[model samples]
Target: MSAADAELRQAFAQLQAQMVETQQRVSALEPQMAGLQRAQLHADATLQQLALAGAGGGGGGGGAENRAYQPVGRAFLLQPLPELKAAAADRRSNADAKLEALKTMKDYLERTLKNSENNLREMVQQRKEQASS
Candidate 1:
């Protein structure tokens, strides 16, 4: 085969390798994404339950002894709520970022594959013309 043919083959091989690798990564991420979605659903359910309990007087039912409870212990306990919110926000952001990145990578791989296939077809056409000549 000519140099052009050989180079075309090499390019296609590299593109195929990249497509395989990226697809594998995308596949691996899918399960994690599903799990995240499930976790988010669970968190929403828990938040709803907490809200209902708070409304129904099921929570904070400590009776007369709880009346003297001052601000000190409450402040310490309430401190973690902000941290928890921040953590959930961060996880959601990370999951969104990762999903976008995977989509971009998938798009790139598809484009590269298409280009490689077209180039290979053109190379074959050129080889045919050269042989005919």
Candidate 2:
């Protein structure tokens, strides 16, 4: 093969490897994104429950005495209701941000894969024409 053909083949190989890696990354992100979405939904629900409880003054008439149990890793800790609500909101926001970032990465990988496929096809066509000539 000519040097140019060799170079094209090398580039095509690299693109194929990149495409495979990107697909793996996308596959990995799929489960993580689902988990994050579930966490966000849980947090939102917790926050809404807190809001409703607070609005109804249903904290056993002690108002600020309401407590909630929050999960920290594998353990649960007691925290004030307001603090728990704030933490849940923060968690939801963080999950939202991470989900967005993953989606963006997925989009970028897809576009790159498409472009690389087109480039490889063009290179192969050129190589075939050169061989025929």
Candidate 3:
């Protein structure tokens, strides 16, 4: 093989490896992304329900003694409604940030995969031309 052909082949192999790794990572993230989306939605729904309950009561003698329970490992902890609300809000924010980060990573991986594929195609074309010469 010509020196140029050898160089192109080596580069193509390396690019192929990188593309495979990127694809694997993207696959791994898909499930986590889906789970995070569900969590975000659940948190948002909980907050909305809480808001509705508080506002719709309109002085239904409920006082400020609202309460809730949050999971703590294998158990549940009783907390005042305000604390639960805060925790739910925090979960929502955290889920949002995580989802955004995962999306950015996926986007970057996709770009890398596209570039690698393009480079491989160009290399193949060059190698073919070299062989024909």
TM-score for each model: 0.53, 0.79, 0.86
> Whole-model lDDT, candidate 2?
0.84
- Per-residue accuracy of model 3 over 1-133 as CA lDDT, tens digit each: 5786678768988989998998999999999999999999999999987766555555444725666667899999877667778888999999999999999999998998899889888988987886789
Candidate 2 residue pairs in clash (backbone atoms < 3 Å):
none
| Candidate No. with top TM-score | 3
Range of the 10 consecutive residues with the lowest summed lDDT in candidate 1: 62-71
True lDDT of residue 30, candidate 3: 99
lDDT of each: 0.58, 0.84, 0.85
Determine which window of 10 residues in candidate 3 has minimal summed lDDT: 54-63
Best model number under lDDT: 3
Clashing pairs in 1: none
Residue lDDT tens for model 1, 29-109: 678667767766655654454444444543465322221211354462333333444455565666577667756776776
Candidate 3 — which pairs collide?
none
Off by over 4 Å in 3: 56-63
Q: What is the lDDT of residue 80 in candidate 2?
A: 82
lDDT string, candidate 2, 96-124, tens digits: 99999988988987888788778778878
